[model samples]
Target: MRLSKLFKNAPTTNVTGLCFDSRKVQPGNVYFCLPGMTHDGHEFIKQAVEKGAICIVHSKELKPEEMPVGAIYIRVADTVDAMNQAARIFYSKPSDKMLMYGITGTNGKSTIANVIRNIRNKKEPTGYIGTIAIEYGNVRLQPDLTTPDALFLQEKLSEMVRHGMKACALEVSSHGLAQRRVDGINFDVAIFTNLTYDHLDYHGTMKSYFEAKSLLFSERVKPTGKSILNIDDACFEKLQRISQAPVITYGIEHECDYRAINVQILPKQSKFDLVYQGKTYPVVTNLVATYNVYNLLAAIAALHETDMDLDVILEACKNLPQVDGRLEQIDMGQPFHVIVDFAHTPDGMKKMFQFGRQIAQTHKLISVFGSAGKRDVAKRKVFGELADQYCDYIILTEDDPRDEDPAVIADQIEEGIESSNHVFIEDRYEAIRQAIESANPGDCVLLLGKGDEPYIYRENGRAPYKGDNVIAKECISKYCRHINEAVDDVNEDESFIEE
Candidate 1:
């Protein structure tokens, strides 16, 4: 790649790749001196040059001495934007080559993204990038962030195009949007699940968080794109106002373009009538809960605008794959039902608890959950209150309490927990053990937060920890796994009901 492609008034030199980290700069690569939340890359320009960076793409004016004998400098107003522009050119604008489906919200993003990818994959090659992993063809990568940085994302999208993928389903996080991580994505379909209380630790307020989310609809979406929204969400109207593309609404409560009517929430699945345009189509989802109906509706609506057959999309919804750590069920032949989820926010917790209660019915619902350190502190007490209202017993345990005292975190959560039926357990493994041991026949054990995450963050760093579902299975083996017979096959029999 020529340096002139990155900038108009730059030296006509060849570059191999791009790098933001000074220590990782390779020979013939363009080093972007971007300003970040922690350290400014400008401070490490000398180190980058020493590490074999040939072209310095920086925002600051570097001294003549800083430019080494073999390197060239290209000063820009904003290095982040410059890096994104470089990625678009280098990666051949992959987002423009395929059908891009972008999902953004506080919760349900991973599930929606996965569902879309799986459905589209039935017809042609489709890629997915979200909290769990990134998959396109034979390539599967563990993601560090829900929405990865611009360079990695663009490269992956380009790879997907090379791998014969016709579509890419991506989860657009508020942090990714706020920080300009996904600046040049030409999203063909932008779907908003819902906005709730989350990431306030970074955004500081609900308004700021929503504003960050609004950027995708306003700026990134193509003018002819479709914006599928959950009209039932509180932020729907505001999102609609910001969306520059045509709006397609889906909800159970509101009168929308795609309405899920005559809904039935089952223990293992949900049945509903998808009233779209004017015709009523009977729909069955392998996933449970009412919120999932909205997810299905959003996915179906988005795919419909992509020129897919609505009937095939609806059939695919009937057999949707289980999104990892999102309401994942663990059955070790235990008497009680043990399920795990990534419901960290208050709104997510409330929904998970409601789903637990819905299935538990007369049976006891025991909640094992905790808040993270240095996060939205106000949501901690609110977590207690929601669990107190929905659970028969609550066990507060560690969920990434980095450098913060466990006792103090527990006290803050317990403030809103007026219920006298909860205990503070510092050891997460022991907390899970106690929850399983305390379960009775037909009872439900709910493990919230740290769903599929494989590490525990302490002052030392991210120590390895088995995921919530993994830990729950281990506990069930020790305390509750009485039926240990080896008789197994895939359960192809789906218990679905429709009106």
Candidate 2:
């Protein structure tokens, strides 16, 4: 392919592919020399050339002596932006062929994207790209990032279009927006669930984090489309002011375009009256939690603007499926209840405990959770504080202690706990076992962080870790067997009789 389309007749080459890593470079491939957090791709220019990269795209201006002899050297203002443009051209700009909805926030990105996918798939072929997995008509791809890089992202969108997918719902992460991963993709709608204390380690402050999230609505989303805002969030007004598109508000407390009134959160489901445009529509969903209610409202607002029938949307909500590891229950005939969630942030942890306590009622709520290492160390103390207040028993364990000592991480988390009911267990499996073993008949066992994540990271590498759900089910099964044995022994007694 020639660079004339992107660079205005700069140069031409028989480009076979695009790559960032020097190890992946092959003959005729163009290498993007982009700066990353830890490594500078410019330093690897010689290696890329040696590995058969035909062209070098970089931001740094190098002398003739430094440039590779045979490879084409091109300097641009920003290598990331240039790479995105190149990828867009290479992939034929597939984002233009499909209707894309972007969901961004601290807590509800996955759930909201899934809800939109369910509703959209009912009408036409719909695809999804998010934390869990990427899905299209018949393809399911496990992504390395919540949002893949510009090259992979445009390639996926092109594949979706080729597969006859008319629309897609993408979870736009703060890192994705900040790193310009979604640069070339155009969004028809951008939905903000809420902003809380998350990714503070990377963004440095909540303000910066909000700015990164705002980019989705303010820049990537089309101004002619819609921007859905959660009015109840503290960041809503700021985001509304910053958004480029028309804002559609949704909330439970405030009067908005879409409101959920008379909400009832039952044990297995949630019921609410969705008030939109002076009409009341009943929305009963399998998902239970105030946060989930907001997610549903966000999904509804995004779809409603696209002229989708409110009736069809409501019907789809009636049996909305539970997102994996998002407050999912593991019931193997256990006397007590066990719920697992991917609540890593402080705000997410508080909400999970709120829901867990509601279900536990007067019974004890035991929590088994840990924070991610090497990222957001500031939230560890807050996690301890929340667990101290909400849980009767707390077991602090490792989520992903990547290169960080699990004991040190546990100590940081323990510092905020005022009560002595918490125990620091470095091994997650043992921590879960202890929490489950201590559970009473009516008590609830809550597992947070590393919900359905398949691996545990150490200094060496990541190994297949038993997921929270799997461990929870194993514990519950043992308890169920004990319960059954006790019942059988009582039945075998001569004095015992059936009614």
lDDT for residue 423 in candidate 2, whole number 0-100: 85
If scored against the real structure, what TM-score would every candidate get?
A: 0.95, 0.95
Per-residue C-alpha lDDT of model 2 across residues 304-414, encoded as one tens digit per residue:
899899999988998877687888988776667789998999899999988888777777999998887788888899999999888988998888888998889989999
Best by lDDT: 1
Candidate 1 residue pairs in clash (backbone atoms < 3 Å) = none
For model 2, give the 10-residue run with minimal summed lDDT.
490-499
> Which residue runs of candidate 2 sit more than 4 Å off their true CA positions?
484-499
The sequence of per-residue lDDT tens digits that candidate 1 reaches over residues 434-478 is: 999998776789999988788889879788989998989888887
* Every candidate's lDDT: 0.87, 0.87
